[model samples]
Target: MFAEEQNPTTAVAGRRLSDQQAVAQFRQVVSRVEPVAERFCKQETADRENFDCDIQIVVDTSMEGRNAYQTYNDAGKPVVGFTIPMIADARNPDELAFVLGHEMGHHIGQHSHKQQQQAVAGALILGALTAYGQASATAANPYRYTGNDQRDMQNSIELGAGVGQMAYSQTYELESDVIGTAITKAAGYDPVKGARFFARPEGKRTANGRLSFWGTHPPDEKRLATVLATIEGIEVSGGISRR
Candidate 1:
């Protein structure tokens, strides 16, 4: 989707790629994102005594065709894992870099850890309320947390757990784009050219959209607009926010 010299640092995930090809794409993506990730987190990573994270990329078909995501190991090392699904066919390196950057942004912004903590806290608070009510007035159960209630609770926690966490995630996406733009540019890629695939056409939707309360990603237009603005700003200012 991009000229190598023109836009060298796009995320590369395509359909039905071989294992070796996928690894090659991943290495290229890491090479693109590493510098941006470092620029995004230099102050702490540069300080050996105060290092906050170590990022590792794990590629496995066993992930059953998932896109890139951030997971935290017990030691709290941030692990970005990707499945074969994101890239449906053979894709260029730029496509891979964007996905790689998105996953990196999850760690860079600390959203994964914060969301994990928020979900747990929300559930615990609700559980305590359920328990206290059960003991108080001989109320069989105030929280009939099953079936739809369970589903609704889950959705609420995911979508409405904390103030603007969802919005913050959206913002981080823009941040990642800016970082990705710079990183890709340095790695010899055009960030905007790579971002075209992310645009959602009218009437078309992802399967995840079929869910009742799928609140993970911003609507495509919203995400695209934000990313475009970030890229434009970077093109004009040359990486102002990170500093």
Candidate 2:
């Protein structure tokens, strides 16, 4: 939803929650999900000491996007930022919880660090290949210069980096969905209902084969299916006690 057109007061849990109220609700959800995040950290990471399993939620009212994301703060701590529009768009606490869980999943999965490593590796490999090709071309004919070799090499490296970044982008998104489902369930919310937020009309339209391969996120339908399957598995294992 567009930030300019969104209502400042939105409904959450069948009642009107202003922006301030929404922020409070977000904090409450985060507090509930912290134990789940800690459990994931213990299970996934070996260096638990350096990993700041504590998650801090920041409500950015000045932000434009109807989205939330996870990143490291200046203090090297995991922080999730919820844009005002995203908060305004949520229909209930469960939706907010799902979004928060997804962002936390990115951190839990160490996707940011992994993606950066992949991009750097891809750039180094591709840059070397480009330089080798340039040298070979120059050796074949010193005067057969196509254009600026430096510029061409830079372009190739950038392209390779982009490809590397997108290589596992869809996979990361799907993995986040799975983790987020588990999180929502563990937090005593209905993961199935939380997944419905992605099945909204706007989400469906955006996922309709628009740059399917290049986009960072998987299609909403695919995400919904993964969430459903994950929730089913969790239920079978009695992983989460429904509230």
Candidate 3:
């Protein structure tokens, strides 16, 4: 049912999570999914970092837009934090687990810094291209030019970056979903119920046709389809198993 990719793997940048509200919610997510994710983290990263594989929930004031993420300082300390609105606004426990798992998935893939670095690099490259294009275009059509061309060029670069990022980022998201489902299940919740969490992306599906859910995330159908597959693999109650 999904259009692109689906599976819990890794993620790009996450929302800041160092605030009181964010901290409480992140702690709740940690309490629920750490058991399962911990093992995955150790396995994924070979326990090479100082993290000891225990996901720590913290608050971040610099975040906005219901985000969660893993961070590493220049000193090589790794931290995993989730945002408040992300968990608080979740439709159910599964969604919360999905967010937490996705963030943890970034750590699992050892891509926390790489993703952010790429995004920043993409922005810089786009900016430089925009300036160069503007200068060259000015020589060609100086009098007819509006700043919109630069904006459009920058937009295209960002758009391309976004698509490329999702191509890879979605892989991580799907991987995290799978891993998150297992963790949420192990935490004693029905992952099927948590699958509703995937619905949050639907709100962004305003356009129709081929571009639906293109810029924001992997298509909803793809996400739900993967989650359903995950649910099938787990030991649930009746049709939906509980851990």
Off by over 4 Å in 3: 1-26, 46-52, 113-166, 201-219, 234-243
lDDT of 3 at 28: 70
Best by TM-score: 2
Stretches of candidate 1 exceeding 4 Å from the true structure: 1-17, 43-49, 87-90, 120-175, 200-215, 240-243
> Which window of ten consecutive residues has the lowest lDDT sum in model 1?
210-219
Cα lDDT of candidate 3 equals 0.59
The sequence of per-residue lDDT tens digits that candidate 1 reaches over residues 1-243 is: 223222435434346667677777777667767766666566534655565645777775775533556777788787877766554432666766765666676666666666667656766666556545445644566565444644555555554456334435666666665555555665666556566545422123345553211134333554455556666776798653642
Q: Compose the digit string of candidate 3's lDDT tens values, residues 1-243.
A: 222213333221135444555456656756767777787667656747655576565655465545556776565666765445555555444556666675666666655455666666676676677878787878898796575985687686786566445445766667666666666676776665665555433444333323322234444665676777777765444222212
Clash pairs of candidate 2? none
The TM-scores, one per candidate, come to 0.63, 0.81, 0.56
Candidate 3: lDDT of 179?
A: 68
Q: Tens digit of lDDT per residue, candidate 2, span 106-185?
A: 99888899999999988988999999999999899989867899899999999889888878887888888888888888
Error of 3 at 191 (Å): 2.1
What value of lDDT does candidate 2 attain over all alpha carbons? 0.73
- Residue 49 displacement (Å), model 2: 5.7
